[model samples]
Target: MIRPDHPASFLEEGPFRTEEDQYFWKALVELTAMEETNQGNLAAFVGVSQGYVSKILAGKQVPKARLRRRFAEFFELAYEDMVALGRQHLESMGYPAEGLPGRRCQVREPAYGGAEAAGRPAAGQGEYSALRSMVRDLRAREAREGTYTEIPLREATASMGGGSTETGDRTLSYLSFRTEWIRSKGNPEYMTAIRAFGDSMEPTIADGSVVLIDEGRRQFVKNKVYYLRYNGQMYIKRLVDAGGRLGIASDSDNNLLLVSDADDFEIIGRCIWTARELD
Candidate 1:
């Protein structure tokens, strides 16, 4: 039995005893969410019923050796990681790690350009031109230093519920900030303005507030509010680093949301300032 003071012992009292176990489960959820695929598709790919996949995601049922390999293949992850996890589980019980599945082929890289491989539009294609124009416009405006700096207002909204998909290629408009005021924080070119929705981050960040994000500051600062994306979901919250495990917390919610390695987590920028209507 693990001690109560152990930090990484999340769900220690549950069916998940080891980090590898939780990683396997989270990897499934994160990959499925990233791919925008449902459990039904995963079931079809893994030769299992949708109910079984649900059980796996819920940590109610552990996948067998064959099913584990199938999951690795479907997610394009290394099967050896799953095999190593199983070996660790067996070895923890004072049992031999022998007779488990061996290593398989490595994951192959996409044979295309970086942007296309990432499913994003390449240069001069799709909405790429619009995005480039926005960048150029921002650069040109920043070059003409004056009393105020022009900050591009993003067309999308950052919701506290972790779901905001209205990302536009071009900026809706620009909000002028005092040149001295904006310069104190960082370069004006790296600053952006975006509307924030949801009340989970109330008091500190009211609903419908226009939040200023310092895109140049991507470094992780504990307890600071940030605009981030995890598992393909956007969020505006304070990040708490509990040892190695990242915890996403909200001003309105007391519970901390644990972020695992499998989560496609990226800190878009740190929230520096906010302007909201007086209610």
Candidate 2:
């Protein structure tokens, strides 16, 4: 671990109080060092002079907010993830939890392939990862802050029968939709795309159907289908009022499962649209 060798602090006085300020900067500097490389490469990655990288490593400088985003890219992490990590580190170092990140964010370990696994140094994984993140963030940011609207096509499948265990939640890609069209359904921010498995909802929602879900619509609406989790299993089924109880049903088979208060049920979203491959 590269210890802070210089006396300069990384942040200006503001959000953090005096007592907590020291640990905040200390945590950030140490976290940044975990991704540090040779001086020249580090400077190039951050688009800064070698001297700036040196000063930063020595804890004598703080990157601006935009540059922090670059650091996030370099570290192959979201900016919010970095902040959450720094908060966790600070708490571990005996700093108070108040005024830090309100929620915990999990930092996933990066998977390395052949070369690194064979005891060789990484071949520009940092640069490549940073570039990918930059492009992905740019596209998502454009959709969020500009006129465009893009819904994420998640890499997941919801079963129509017994229930499918969700494999992953990564965004495989995005599906562009008209801003006006999305608004007519629900909030654009809550929209996502996932595939449905099994023929249980066939004739209504077929097997291999790409379903558009509005995750914000968690309220129970009678006769509406939903992507939900029941007892730790994922499903796409119509929700109905079962006389003060909740009912889950498959369309094609007309199978119904009533939920009691003791059952664990969570509504992920309301299905608003669907598409299936012709073949």
Highest-TM-score candidate: 2
Q: Which stretches of candidate 1 lie over 4 Å from their true place?
A: 1-145
Clashing pairs in 1: none
Q: Candidate 1, 139: how far from true, in Å? A: 21
Report the C-alpha lDDT of model 2 over 190-216, residue by residue, as the tens digit. Answer: 889999988998899989989999999
Candidate 1: lDDT over CA atoms?
0.68
Query: Per-residue alpha-carbon lDDT of model 1 for 1-279, expressed as tens digits?
Result: 222344344444455555465546544543443344556777999999988887776556668767877997775445565444334433443522222111111111221234456465544454334333433454454445456788999886788766686656479998888899999999888888888999899889998999999989988889999998877777789899877878999899796889887878899899999999787
Candidate 1: Cα lDDT at 194: 88
Candidate 1, residue 217: how far the Cα is off, in Å: 0.7
Cand. 2 Cα-lDDT: 0.68
